[model samples]
Target chain A: MTIRKIDIFRTGLRTFFIQSLWNYESLLAYGIAFSILPILIKLYSKRDIIRKGREYLSYFNSQPYLAAFILGMLIKLEEDAVENSINNNSKISSVKASYMGPLAAMGDSFFWWCLKPATLIITIFLVMYFNDFSNALFLLSFFLIFFNAFHLYYRFGSISFGYKYGEDGLKFFQKFNMNLFQKVMFQITFFLLGISITMLVLKFPFPKLVENIEIFKHIEFQIFYGISVIFLFFIYKLKRSPLLLILTTLIIIFIFSFLKEKNLVFLRIN
Target chain B: MIFKVLLAGLISGLFQLDQTGAFQFMLSRSIISSTILGWVLGSIIGQPELGLRYGFLFGIFFDLIWLFRLPIGASTPPDYQIGSSVAISSLILGISFFNPKFIYIYVFICLVMGFVSGYIGAWFDVIIRRLNINISRMSRYYWNKGKFLKFKSLMLLGLFNSFVKAFLITIVFLFLILILNPILNFIFENIPGFIVEGFAIVIFFIPALGLIVVINHIIKESTWKVLGLGIVTGAIIFSYLKDFHVFGFLIILFFCIIIWVNVLKKEKV
Candidate 1:
């Protein structure tokens, strides 16, 4: 019997609990095997089923969300293997394994690197600016449902493509441009980061900038602030980590703080 | 009390870090984890504000700090959810338990605990993932019989193991905090006030470091102008409109809207 809709749906849902069997040696191998248990059981009887399990329970990892696409594709491959009695076990595993790295790179960039922060920064902006704690729970829930559902929807769609065309379905990955979304979201996140940082600087005056309102209004101070932020851009350009910028800035601030505490404060711009 | 905290710990850990993540539904985020914790504590204390306010602050900072922790491939980032939950709930509960009259030092301790627990939590995750691998060999039995139900049963055994892992982490974290809290309180009471102020300063400064890290991510030649423009808007708001917080957020909001529309509009073109 061919795979039915109920089976596809069950496997998709089981994808969530996949990491329950996670281990370092094969990473998510056992989890992958577990997710496709029904398909394996139906396709292979007795020892053959055990062989399929053993085949899957070896070294697998990916961005978990994108793994759904891989899972969908693997189910189709497995079904094809049984239907044709093809000795394609190695091909199936390799196909799943190969897709993991690239999909992970894409998912990590799009979901982890981009969307995660974008939603977070948006939430921070809303909560802090309004200072309204109301619906903080609702907002969190809304975010959880929206982003998770977006990827899940994509995963369900991905499975169909994977089944119909096998490896060719990967070409569809190109049609989905995550870079543009990432760019826009990154822009907004940076803009808000600027605001949030400025708010902190103002809320907790950097000892030296505390003295005069006029000091900040000065073009020199504006330029100084601009340059400092641009310096952050440079730090990123050098392919240096963000942690370095934070440490350096913190050291700079601490030194200024120490100097001020010792009455070694410098002359004012005025 | 222990049971209550244990239950919260399980929910936080499982919800945030579930590996299979059905339909991509698990958030596994510090913000949501801590918020859920805070809301739980708030409901217990009959003070929604307590849960929400603390959750928001702790969540924001944790979100900022963990920005770098994108768990790609087999590599795992520090498990901020379990750590933050342990840290947040301990402090929130402390307020009620000790009936502390002041807030600042308590908040400072929570910040420090956040880092401490985050480190521990990350290590715990590594350990659990390592241990869970053992289940793979055992899954062979179910596989032999083509027993899909048995396979799911084994996976549940593994999922329960996850909760067990979380339980261990939370217990250790809470135990240390409890043993140290009294001595620390005494020392804190005796210490010079500036030291306390310094802690507060450091805690407040954390957001900036976190924010800077995020800004660092989007840096590119093309984005520099956008970056510059954002800084200008921010500085102007800082310099002139510090008091106009909402109006300023609106200004930023207005900019975001225009930028979003322009980008989407351009893509369509």
Candidate 2:
């Protein structure tokens, strides 16, 4: 017998909860393990088991954490449907497992390690710049939860799509590559980093300017624009190392300090 | 369990030290174990800050050891909890012994202790793997015999391994701290300011390494080039709005969103 839609959803949720027990390392390992169930079933189970197992495995593969929490749930689901040996299949299960591993790695690297930290760092810097640690922490927590929630939603949606479309759905995603989403995310990250760095540089003391204008008056926005252009040039044309860039910035800061000390240049702000 | 924790801590610390190449000689000269060994003694004797400072400094030397990925020879020490506990306990004992000078002697001792702990943890891992294999076989046997207890056993075994590792490592370090407190305090007092500052810089850079890893992953040629542009643009906007209070960032964020949604959004499409 074929696996029902509801059964697949229930199993996916169950797998998610179970997989959550494992720590980061264990979760990755287990996700791979469970994803291969279809292959295992194909090899050992009879024809009917192969079919049903393939259907179930496809749904499991699409779930978040690559259905890390769903391994046990998938196993349990298989056990429940054991009587319907007609629908259980193995080949499909293996295929799902094989695909999900790479997908999980991509998700884990992009979302967990890179984007999340970048967002949090930018937010934290802004908060600190504003002298609002409380709100910063709040925003930090919010983003963390928000990201995780999105992960869950995507996992669930993917799995549901799998149940409805099977291998076809997986193929579609592979073909499309979520390019649009990625571009948007990259843009967001770029904007945040750009603004935060600009603020940081402007806040650096401009002794000469302070003397003439009421230091805070007339908003010398041009300096920020100029510095940003310089930063862009360094990042683009020089392809300089972050360490080098940081060192250069520090050296510039020191030079500025030395100049101020020597009275080489002064800005008199009204 | 406590012994295991102490052992893991020692192992992690030793691994950290071993990674330091020649720096191990310096740590060897200065008594280091007292700070970490203090944890096992159930008293906060060693300076937690100092252990981290030294641990970080010690970490720089051990960079070569990180290639193996085994905690045995890595520059990054195991968790800080292990060293901190040991250090604290040692300081307490040093004060009690009336020979605070003895505290410095513990550094070398702690390094040795860490090495032994690494070996112990490695041995335990091997044993756990063997047990897992045996259990899997046993489960298969039971399944062949129409018995289902193997599944339950597997779950229990997995839980046991994770707990054991975490628990044993914590315990071993705590024990080391208890025994070595006296010598640690004596050494802690004599460490030079410059050495401390050097170590501090090392600690500060560790997170930067983590950042590099993240950066490398993000800056692939195809996807992340625009990230540079966004940063440059945002910086320019920020420089202009510096005096406007927090509202500056908010306004910047708003403009960014618009640029993202409209300009970049169209290009991507």
Candidate 3:
């Protein structure tokens, strides 16, 4: 069964609608669409690639919600290759299959898992703090609109770029140095998470007093920060595994829990 | 419309319990609840405003109960059906009698119901996970197949789980409604003050665990320094401005952009 462009678009749209019904599980449907549609689309149009690409772009641009739905559906679509190969003995290139999983993971973890959640959390906090219910509604609307817009633009861009650049796009990403991007994002997220943790621990009744405090007044904050610093120092100086640091922190927390229970030297307050 | 709203609410109630295995964080959002409920109950009932208000308020109350991780088992303390029923009932009352004042009563009923529903849901989880060995076996078998059958089975399981949870919650809510006045009087007569404070402390700590996890993930040296800088900058801006939403985000974003542009640009040069 040869796959036409209309078939691809319709399949993508149907998958998107079905996935939207469930929310988080929608990503699985999305991943399926991206994988199967591309393979199917490739078989139909060998010559009019540019024209087909333009048509796809226009279709997506005209329907932002449809675009977002398709992008989300692509999340589960990549798994099709793995399932098909295992079940039907169909061959998918190791490189293609291997890269797609990590790429999906990166997209899922970074954008959906981290960024979206963090944004929503922050927005909720802001709304609650300010008592701006209308603003909260606005923020929710903004998220839906913004994400859909990006999904629409990027879905077309990725497929078109993939078709036009072919192996070059794949090779470019394979060889591309993401260390700088990784380092910057890592630092920013780390900093935000740290400050959030400290503030949460402090939970200071008076904002003025927290503001006046020259340094970390909350002992719990100081303890966690100090432990984090020690872990960081060890990583830099001794080149220890990150897992070691995580284990050490957990151990310290456990010990702290016991110490507080035992009343071992200024551990408990009131 | 009433039937659809009931179906959606029942599904939502069950979804909250995670009984359905069909968890969508977005659907659980207060805005989505309001929008969906408003759409369903608005046109037919001619009470869109009430639906919007109660749907959101009840949703948030539901979320809060889940967030607090209240220990209510065997005997229902608070639950979602109570909230949904109260909200829906009040909306019905207001529309039928043309009395908007009933909305306040609706809100209070919903709050109490939310507490009850959450407890019942938790209890249901404990009960089902213990007793439903066949469900677990089915879940595992389908999970391994990686086929359409697996997906279909999971979806069916989700639907069944949700239906069961909703039915259980509805029963609990109905039971509570029958004994509401007496229970309220008993609570007013009995529970200690210090216990309330202890509950408050537990609630405070629950949300902090999420922050702790995020913090624990960033224990690297360079990241720590950057974090320190970000906090100091955030604090300073917050001190001057009082509201630091945009400022805090921009400061962090700017710091990141500068570091990345300098490092990558230098390497390129």
Clashes of each: 4, 99, 21
Chain A TM-score vs. truth, each candidate = 0.73, 0.53, 0.39
In candidate 2, which residue ranges exceed 4 Å CA deviation?
Answer: A1-10, A17-64, A67-137, A171-177, A190-270, B1-134, B142-146, B149-153, B171-184, B193-209, B220-245, B262-269
The TM-score of candidate 3's chain A against the true chain A comes to 0.39
User: Distance from true position, residue B200, model 2, in Å?
Assistant: 6.7
lDDT of 1 by residue, B75-157 (tens): 67666676567767777666654424334566656666766667776676677677766666666666666676776777777
Q: Rank order by lDDT, top first? A: 1, 3, 2
DockQ-based class of model 1 = acceptable
Q: Write the per-residue lDDT of candidate 3 for residues A217-265, one digit (tens) a residue.
A: 4475346444554454454235433334334444444454454446555
Error of 3 at A201 (Å): 7.9
**What is the TM-score of candidate 3?**
0.47
Q: In model 3, which runs have C-alpha deviations exceeding 4 angstroms?
A: A1-4, A17-89, A92-108, A121-131, A145-183, A194-270, B1-188, B194-207, B217-221, B238-240, B243-269
TM-score of each: 0.82, 0.51, 0.47
Instruction: Estimate, for each residue in A1-270, the C-alpha lDDT of model 1 and write its tens digit.
Output: 699878888877777776667777776677778778777777777677777665686688887766778888888888887888897778877887789888878878787777877877776765555555676777677667767665776666676667667788876676767777776787777677666665554443333212244444444434444455556546644765544654555554454344334543241224
* lDDT agreement of model 2 with the native: 0.40
Error of 3 at B154 (Å): 11
Pairs of residues at least 3 apart in sequence or in different chains that clash in candidate 1: A16-B20, A16-B21, A16-B22, B16-B28
Best by TM-score: 1
